[model samples]
Target: MSMSGDPVLERVRAIEDDFADAMSRMYTVGNELATLRARLETEASPAQWTPVAEPAAPPTPAAATAAPQPSPVPTAPAGLVTPPPPAHAPAYAPAAVPPPARPLPPAEPWWQRDGVVAKILAVVGATITLIGVAFLLALAIQMGFFGPVARVTSGALLAMGLVGAAALVRRREAGTVGALGLAATGIATAYLDVLAVTRIYDWVPLAGGMVIAGLIALGGVLLARAWDSQLLAVVAVLGVALMAPFVGLDHARLTGAFLLVLTIATWPAQVGRRWWALELARVVPTGLFLAALALAQERTAVPVVLALGLAVLVVGTTVAGTRSERLPLQLGALVPVGVMPVWSAGVAAPDRWVGTALLVVATCLLLLAAGLVVHREGTAPQHRVPEIALAAAGVTSLTAAPRAVDGGSLAIVAIVGVALVWAVAALVLRQRSVLLVAWGLGVIALLGSLALLPYVVLRSQAGDVGPRHLVTAVLLVALLVVTARASDRIIPATAPVLSRALLALAVVSTGGAVVVSGVLLGQLLDDPRGGFTAGQAGATVVWMAAAALLLLRGLRGSTIAVPAGLTLAAASVVKLLLFDLAFLGGLARVVSFIVAGLLLLGMGAGYAQALERSRREGTDRTPPGPPPGPVDNPTAPTPIPPTV
Candidate 1:
C-alpha cells in the first residue's frame, strides 16, 4: 500500500510472497501424498494375489561383494515446487506467524437500518405539509382572496388530489412509509375540508357534515385494512380524533356523537388484528372526550350511552377473537370501560336510579364473566379476563351500594355481601386470579366494615352490637375463609409465600369471628352486671378453647397445626394474663382464670397422652427381640456351645 517504496520494504514484500508460495507448495505436497497413499491402498487390496514365502538359495560372490547403489532423489510435481528465496534477499531469523483474522459482527436488521428513519421523515414531512395547507386555507379565507364557493371547491379539489396521489404512491410502493404517510395526511385533509364546508362556509349543515366526516374516517380505516398497515390505521384514527373538537365546535352533544362515530368507524380495524396501538388510539380519545363532557356537567345521556356501547364493543370484539391474546391487552381494554361509569353515576346523574342502573350493569358484567368461564376451551389463561371482570364488578358494586342503600350500615353490609359473592364465584370457577380479586375486595370491604363494629369490644355498650354489624362480620369471615380455601385449590403449592399468607388470613379470620360472636352473645344476654367485662372474659375462654382444639389436631399428626396451635396458645395465655387480669373482676375474673387453667391443663394432658400412645404403638410395631445374633457374654456361652 505504501507508494514511496524503499528497498527494505520491497525486500519484505518479496519475502512475504515467497512465504505464501512456500505454504501453498507445502499444502499441495501434503494433498499429493494423501492421493498417492489412497491409490496405493486401493491397488493392494486383500482380493489381489500375493506370492508365498519360499526358501532362499546361496548368494553368489559378485552379488554379495557389490554395494547397494544410492537411491535417486524424488522431485516434487512441477506446479507444486516451492521457489527458493533470492540470493540478494537479506538473511534474517524467521518471523512469528500472525494470528488469524477475527470474523466481522452481524449486520443490523433492515428495519433498523433504514425503515425507521424513512418513516419518521415521511410522517414529519406530511405533518408540515398539512400545516401549510391549513395556513393557506386560513389565509385565503382571511384575505377574501376568493369567494366562498371557489375556496370550498379549491380545498375539496386539493384534498381529492392528495388522496389520488396517495393511491398512486401506494400502487407504486405498497407498505412503504411514503404510502402510509400520504394516506394519513390525505384523510386528515379531507376531514378538515369537510369541516370547513359545514362550519365556515355554511355550505353544508352540521348533520350532513358529520355524515361526510364519518364516511371519510371509515374510508381511511378501510384503506388501512386493505393495505394491512397498523401504522396507517393508527395515524388515520389519531388524525380524525385531533380534529374532532373543531368539527364539534365545543358543543358537548355534537362532540360525544362525533367521538362515538369515530369509535364505530375504527372498530372494524381491531376485529382480529390485535393492533393495540389502533385500539388505544380509538379508546383513549373517546374516553378523554367523554371525561371532559362529564366534568363540564353537560347533559350526559349521549356520553353514558357511548361509554356503555364502547365498553360492550371492546369486550365483545376481544373475547370473540379466536386467537389467544395476552392478558395485559385484555385487561387494558377493560380499564377505560370500568372507569367511565363513575362519572355517569356521580356527576351526570347523581340519583339513586343511576346507581341502581350501575348495579344492573355490574350484574351483567359478572354474567358475561360466568359465560366466558363456561364456554372457553383451551389451556391458555382465558380465566384472567373473567378475573378482571370480577374485579371491575367489585369496584362497581362498591361504588353503587352506598347510593342504592339509605344507611351507611346497610351499605357496608351490601359491600361485604358483594365481596362474599365474588369469593364464592371464584371458588366455583376455580381460578387463582379470580380468587385474588375476591380476597382484595373482601379485605377492602372488611376495612370499611371495621367502622361499623366497636373498635374495643369490651368497652362498648350492649346496644353497640347490631344485626347489621353481626351480619357484616359473619359475611367477612365467610368471605376470607372461602377465598383462603379457593387459594389453596387454585394456587399451586409451589407458591409457598402466597399460600402461607392466605392461611394466615384464614386463621386470623377464624379467631376474630370467635371474639365477635362472644361479644354479640354477651350483648344478647343483657347481663345486668357489667356485660362488657363478662364478654371480654368469655372471649378469653373462647380463645383458650380454640387453642386447645388446634393443639389436639396437632397431636393427631398434622404438621401445620402444630405451629398454629402453639402461636394461638401463646396469644391466649398473653390475653388471659395481661387483659383479663386487668379488665375482669369479681366472679368473672375468677371464672376466667379457672377456665383458662382447665383448658391449659387439658391441652397439656392430651398432648402427653398422644405422645405416650404414639411411643407405645411404635414399640408394639417393633420386633420382640433385636434379632437372633451373637450372645452378649461370649465366654459364658462356651458351656452351651460344647453341647452343640
Candidate 2:
C-alpha cells in the first residue's frame, strides 16, 4: 500500500486524488447553485432582479443595507469572471450582452419522483394483506381464549385505522395510501359484517353490523376525495365490499340491495369527473348482478336482477351512445340482449307467451327510443328510427313468434296481427323498413287468407259459424285493407307497372274473399253441412257473370277491367268443370253447367259490344278541317312584290 515504492503507481494515485478533488468542487458548486436558485425565486419580479456579483470594496457604514444594481449578466458560467478593460479601450463602452439561459432540468417520472406506483402498491397490498390478517384474527377469536372479545377488538382496529387514514388525507400528506388504507378498512369491516350475518347465533344484530360496514365505505369516499384520483380506486374497492353479499347471502332482496349500492359507488366521480368511472359503472354492476345470479338458490333472483340490471343498462347505454361512447355501450348492452332471449325461450306456457310479448314490445320501444334520441342528439341518417325499430322488432318476433305459433291459432293470429299493425303503422309513417315488412306480411296474409277459406267452409258446414268467428273475420279483413291502402302512396315511383299489377291482385283477392264468405254465410243458416253444392256453384257462377259484365261496363274507368273480365270468365269455366262436374248430379248439375256456360258466353258478347261501341265513338270525333283550303282567294291578285 506504500506509494513510494512504485513510481507509476504513485502517478496513478496522484490522478485519482485530482479526480476526487474535482468532484468535491462540483458538489460545492452545486450547493451554491441551489442557494442561488432559492434566492432568485424570492427576489425575482418584472421590475426587480437579484445582483449576481458584489463590489470589490466593502460598503461604508452609511451605505450598508442599500440595494445593489443588477449586473448586465444575471448569472455567469461557473469559474468565469468579468474581464478587466484594456488600457487602450475607448472611454465610451457599449451595452453588455446578456448571458445564455440555463438549461431546464429533465422531468422525473411520477413513479420515480412522487412515489405514485409505490403508493398504489402499498395501499392495495396492505388492503389485501389485511383480509388475511383478519382471518387470522377471526381464527384466534374462534379459539377459547378471546372469542367473545374478537368483535370488540376488530371493530376498534377498523375505527382506529380509518381515523388515522382520514387524518392523513385531511393533512394532504397521504397521497394514494390514505385511500388504500380507507379501502382496506372497508374490506376488513365487510369480512366482520358478513361473518356476523352468516353466523347469526352471535350477539351482534346483523342489521347493525351492516350499518357499520356502510359507514366504513361512506367514510372512505370522503377521505378518497381528498386523495385526488385515489378516490376512484377506493370507490371500486368499496364496490367489491358491497359485492360480498352476492357470494355468501341467499337473500334475494339483499343481492338487489348490494347491486344498488355497487351502482351508486361506481357512479361517475363528481370531482374532476374521473373518466374511468364510466367504465367502472358499466362493469361493476354487471359483475355484481352476474355474481348474484350465479350464487342464488332462488329462481326469483334471475328475473329481479335481470329487470334491475336492464334498467340501469338501458339508461347508461342511451346516455353513452348519445355521448359517442359507442363501443362500451354496445358491449354492455349485448350481454343483456343475449340473455333475455334465452330467458324468454326457457319460460313455459302461458307465462312464456307473456314474456315473449314483453320482449317484442320492449325491443321495439328501445329501438325506437334509441333511434330517436340518437337522431335528435346527433346526425343519424334518414329512416334511422324506423329501420332500427323494425329490424329489432323482426329479431324479437322471430324468437317469440314461433313459440307463439306453438300455442295455436289464437296465438298465431295475435302475433301476426301485432306485426301487421306495426308494419302498417310504419308504412303510413313513411318508415321504409315497415313498408318492406308490410309488403312481405301482406303476401303471407294473402296466402293465409286463401288457405283459411276452406277451413272456414268446413267449419261452417259443421255449423261452426258463431257470432265471434264472424266478428274476428270482419276485423281481420278491415286490417288487411288498411295495410294495403297505407302502402298505396308509394305506387307511382316503385315500378308503376308492378304496382298496378299488385293493386289488381289485391282487388281480385278481396272480391274473392267476400264472395266465399258471403255465400258460406247463407249456407250456414240453411244447412249444417252445406259446402260446394249445386245451388252454391250456381250462385257463384251468377256472381262471376255480374263481376265480368260490370268490369266490361267500366273499361273506360280502368285498363285492368278487361283482364278482370277475362279472369271472371275463366273462373266461371273452372266452376263448370270442377264443381258442377264433380259434385252435382241430375237436375242440379245440369242447371250449374247451364248457368256457368251462359255467363261465359254473355261476358264475351258484352266485351265485344263494348269494344265496338268505343271504336265507333272514336271515328265520329271531329276531323282536322281539310288542310287550310288551298291558301284562300288566289283572287286578291297577290299584291305582288313591293318596290324597294
Could you tally the backbone clashes for each prediction? 0, 0
Candidate 1 wrong stretches, greater than 4 Å: 1-114, 137-151, 174-176, 199-203, 249-251, 269-274, 287-304, 323-349, 366-391, 397-403, 449-454, 457-463, 494-529, 623-644
Clashes of 1: 0
TM-score for candidate 2, residues paired by index: 0.47
Give each model's whole-structure lDDT. Answer: 0.66, 0.51
Report the Cα lDDT for residue 621, model 2: 82
> Measured by TM-score, how close is model 1 to the native structure?
0.71
Instruction: List ranges where model 2 is wrong by over 4 Å.
Output: 1-309, 312-386, 393-409, 437-481, 488-526, 531-554, 557-568, 584-598, 620-632, 636-644
Give per-residue CA lDDT, model 2, range 1-644, as digits (tens): 67678989657555554544454444445445544654565465333333433212222323321323232212222443323345533222323447768999899868786666766775676667667766866687678555545665665666476656646664664455554555555545554544554344345544444455555555555545555544444553444454446443555455445545544554433334434444444344545454445334345545444553544454454445545543222322333332342334233324555556555555555554444444434443532443544555555554465555554555435544655665567656766566776666555555544544553434344344343333334445555555555556644356545554555554444444443454456566674344335335645565576568557656686766666666666666775677557755676677767776776677668778988888898899878686655655456556677789
Q: Which residue pairs of candidate 2 clash?
A: none
